[model samples]
Target chain A: MSEIPSKWKCAVIQLHSKPMQLEDNFNRAQGFIRKAAEAGARLAVLPEYSLTSWVPDDPGFADAHVDREYLSKFCELAKECNINIVPGTFVERHVDDGKDMLYNVAHFISNEGKILGSYTKKNLWHTERAHLEAAGNNPHTVMDTPLGKVGLLICWDLAFPEAFRALIIQGAKIIIIPSFWNLLDLTEPAFQRNPRSEAIYLESIVISRAFENVSCIAFANVGGQKESGFAGLSQIAMPLMGDIARAEGAHEQMVIGEVDMEVLQDAEESYKVREDISRPDFHYPVYAKN
Target chain B: MSEIPSKWKCAVIQLHSKPMQLEDNFNRAQGFIRKAAEAGARLAVLPEYSLTSWVPDDPGFADAHVDREYLSKFCELAKECNINIVPGTFVERHVDDGKDMLYNVAHFISNEGKILGSYTKKNLWHTERAHLEAAGNNPHTVMDTPLGKVGLLICWDLAFPEAFRALIIQGAKIIIIPSFWNLLDLTEPAFQRNPRSEAIYLESIVISRAFENVSCIAFANVGGQKESGFAGLSQIAMPLMGDIARAEGAHEQMVIGEVDMEVLQDAEESYKVREDISRPDFHYPVYAKN
Candidate 1:
């Protein structure tokens, strides 16, 4: 087991990114990282597609191979600010068996600026399937970090609890999700009953994941109006306290909260969720080993 | 696939049963079932341990083998009232080999008074483990019923998403949970952080389950004060409109809501969670076939 700190602070930076504006988005994210570091946050997270936004169709946007340089800038920022970072996700073009394939990927960076690990989004949103290929093998990414054993997931992946289960089984204590989730994701007829369906889904899912897995979840989502397709509600949640810190609305801001290992330990003792899963006699669904 | 009705009404009867008062509890449950049927509900659910309140250590309570009689009364009530029922859970004593074992079990009864299926609680609560043996084989119960494909799960089982996944994979469209869940489930330190932590957990989990599975959830919890260990938030939740009807507070009441198959179909199409899981190429967690 990795040595985990008793208490540490983290921040979810909810930012609005302009489509196709890589440098501008990076600079804005950099500003948020500096601010979070100044606020004594040991780890900071950014929203999905923070670099080039989520315009899937534009060939120009797809051709702009900025993932490497974009990641380098985030690594430099992490080292400079002396904090760990999850630089949201960027679209990566990989040639698989002579065909071009695009994958949405999120990376975890250490405070010393080393890339820890990356997770390609396994569950793609309906529209994104047309443009992006979901990760085919060993999709879950859980790695040791200065913050603790951390796991990484992306936007629509939040809807699938199996992804979270796989990570928890692998001993992920702090799961960071970088999402570009939007309220408009629901159909019009469905939304007619409850206008805040997606909002409820985001809040409920985050809290449920924390409590069920007996872990902490830091969700960073883009902020904007419903028309812009951003459901901000970026939040930091632990087992007992659902949302210690959360974005007030769908607006650009940094939400900060503390993760106390003592409280998490107490919850583990009270709930025994991890213990139950670990027992050889107790049967629960887990990802089949490849 | 069973033909599901376009629209139907259901009721979650939040009842507080006196400890060991099997007769009175059955009478009260029958009254509520009649009320629900009068209110045009096709199905009605009761809270766990409704026949004998959850006094785990009472030897007298354990020896009182009322499971058969209690279920008989419920089946008769279903026939009389013309309503399907999930009559909460009962302690069943079954002789395994040479020893007697107690199991916490829930059942699904058709409106015609036939027992559709029974599910023994697989994930026992910390306290429940002492008195009840968790189901060791085929824990999930998803059966064809008048209400289409329905699933039955007991209280603590809600904490494990894998349980829900198993049921959904078995073609359950409406999941019913009979819970004796209480706010006092949390430890002192957890309560200090958020006194309403369990409430948040119950509500959030219900909504999250409904949304994530693209199915309807009827959670029936005992209603009473925190001292009594009843966290009554009995609710009927569907994908888009979470908690269409929920208990006003921790009180004895019947919460009714309409379930529209059309709305469920719309959600299934919008989320495509079922479609994603059904695709053999999309690897997700499911219970190992026995």
Candidate 2:
């Protein structure tokens, strides 16, 4: 295992992708990655479905052929920029028991252009349930990297604390969530009380997850207007400092922040969350049978 | 089971208790309960350690003899005010096997003065772990009440999402937390960045829990100056409205809000979080063997 850096910078690229325009989306993402790398970021993460822009109904959107080429481009970019990359998610088509199925997948690439790990989004959003198959019963994806153990979760998985808990328990020091959440996710009644309800949920949960797990959280979300329903609040949050850097609004931007192991170590000494969870006598009941 | 009201008011009584002044604290808590009931609140909650304050080193603070009488007084107040009560927590000294042990415990009392259920705080704070025994391996306490299936958690337990998950999985619609969180809980380095880090944690986690679980979270915290470390941000939050009512600062006051079942039902329909969790194929890894 390589020695982990004690201090480094990370960036979340909040991109506004053109729906179904793969070339335009890739070009924009590449530009953001270059900017992040130039700004001294060792890791840069993009929003979920950045390549396809979340247009599930578009013709040939789920084609498996496009995914491999798109990932190869991201790998080449990682090597060229000399930065680790989490290039959002792409739809994956696989055959299981003679039936074709689609899954949303994300990959981690090293600066040397190695595919470190690949994770299929386990908890699908309500709408995605209709078109995508989740990787149920699979363990959370936690990969050992030069930055320390890193884990990945997709948009809707943010709502489930269990996913975060599973990763942290596996010794993940940094958890990255690539999200495509929007303001209009909530219903009409909820919007009446607070039009920014979804935004509040995204920000609060991201900060809370960092604090509670005593880990760093990099949340990258898409950018657009309220009418476009893109609730952009991309941020890099730490346990004690909350959001060290956050996007100002629903706009295409790169939010960067320092990820210091010292701060996390101090937080652990103060809170001892991981220590408590590791105690042999510690237990919390789980009602789920499977 | 009794008929649960579709819409009802709940109050979080944020009190500043005098150390070891049980009588004065009881009187103040009773006054707040009467005021809440008069304001049409069907349920009222108090902060943890409200009766004896948080002086753990005080002599006779954990006496078993005083707890029963203190709880009886709360039951009497509940019947007199015609409101359900969660009168914070008390240090309970119980005989286990051949030894005596101390556990931090909370209870739910009906308007009829019946002790519906009792919950021993399972997740003890780092400091408390030295003196208090946690109720490890015990299932979370959720009881059927006129307000619906209600659950209880105390103080530091708020940091552990597993406690909330256990109760919600058992069908808890309303989760009440009695907290004694303080602004000075974070280390010096953390405070240098933001002195309000603990406050942010309390508020964000409360709102996030309500949103993610699609349940009502009523949080009652103590009030005091920053010098005293009290980070009072008592709130009543629901699925749709993040915080229907909240205390403005570290001050003694009662925050009341309406818990509408219709709004929760609408959120459930829109988010379908509960539906997804209930799916047979839903699974997330748990590394803990116990």
Candidate 3:
């Protein structure tokens, strides 16, 4: 096995995303990239649909999005910052079968200004199912990089452990989540009264997922206003230790932390936790036809 | 489908056990059952290995452990209290292939003094793997009860979402967990610095698991003292409201709450969440040969 990196600095770019606004989002992303570069980070992540926000209102809007200029700009940002970058997610417009199709694609940008590989979100949220195309037949993968094997997931995909475990089995040392987790005032009376509860739920899940998998999870979430609320508690959590850096509320901020694998010796060897699930007794419904 | 119950009250019996003292354990369990029955709880849950403390110090002890009298007292407690009971877990002593084997079993007792069904734990925690036998070939089943389709899960099984999701797919209305989550000062510097972090991680995961599945979860955990600490925090969590009733810290206490189907209308109809995982873009290592 390759020597686990002793020190790996990462940054999360949390933004106050304006829905359907391209220039505003791009400029804001550029600022975060610049800040991350200044902080000497080796890897950086942005929130889901960082350049366009979430749940597109217009169908035709994705047709012309993320063209040559947009794609090159991200590649250039990675090159300029000299950091491996995950530019949240972009609505990739392309031709599938005989018709037009758009998928939410999370791309891994190499430090040398090249697109390494990408993962199309398989699990689409209820709101996105009607608005976006799902990667129904796609295979899961881990993006190989100098820092480590990085697993990528979009917003709603966080709800499924199957996706995360797949990446871990394929040797994912770090998992990156780009979430537009804006938990608004729901019609449910209880949720309405306790608006911040959703954020708390999310923050808790992030820590548990990281500890269970024995990998570093970098979560980047968007910041939203009061009416269209966002429970923006983005964090970087490591195995067993929980969150080292956490952003609070719907305020635009940047969270930075070092994800060091050298520190996980006690967890990996003592428990053999990853091996705990190796037995054949468990079941997964994804493969179940019924 | 059977009509979802309008309101169902449940109880979680937390204990600070004296290992191997079956009388002390049973007497304590009886006291809690009596209290829950008085509080109008139709269903009561006890912690894992409630009949005896975990990892039998001596092998011969199992032969004399769960006698007919001990078993009947639990059943009689359920019958007397007039409440359905999940007696946490009993270390069932049985002979297989002319050799003695011990298995941890979670039993469901009917209010009418009948054995409704039982679930043997498939996933054994690392501490117990060397000391106890695993349920490799056992078929998973949700206990059919008057309250709801109660799916049973033990501690350490909580880390594996695959097992949890399987229960949800089988139409589990309320998932019951019996955990003995004891926190200790870790050798790892980070986890050692903050001992209560594991409990925090667990609390977060419980809330998310319930909300995501749209199932009510009744968690029962044991209490612990200074050196060998237990992060009790046993809770009754619902779809969107998070924890309605939670036991704070590692204190022996009974938490009671009504699992109401009326309040879940907003969560169930608006999002066909279980259907969100319908597509086949997933992976599971349990099926992996290697």
The candidates' interface RMSDs, in order, read 1.6, 3.4, 4.3
Sliding window of 10 residues with minimal summed lDDT for model 1 chain B: B281-290
Per-model TM-score versus the true fold: 0.96, 0.95, 0.92
Winner on lDDT between 2 and 3 is: 2
- Which one wins on TM-score? 1
TM-score of chain B of 2: 0.95
**Total backbone collisions for each predicted model:** 0, 0, 0
lDDT of candidate 3 over A74-104, digit per residue (tens): 8998898888888888888778888888888
Q: A265 in model 3: Cα distance from truth in Å?
A: 4.0
Higher-ranked by TM-score: 2 or 3:
2
lDDT of 1 at B120: 90
Model 3 stretches with alpha carbons more than 4 Å out: A1-4, A64-66, A185-194, A278-290, B1-4, B185-194, B263-265, B277-290
Clashing pairs in 2: none
Which clashing pairs does model 3 show? Answer: none
Candidates' chain A TM-scores = 0.95, 0.95, 0.90
- Model 1 lDDT tens row, B60-137: 677665549779888898998888999998888888888888988889998889999998988889888778887766
> Looking at every candidate separately, what fraction of the true A–B Cα contacts under 8 Å does it contain?
0.72, 0.58, 0.35
lDDT string for model 2 (B120-177, tens) is 9888887787888888867776899879999899988888888887777778889999
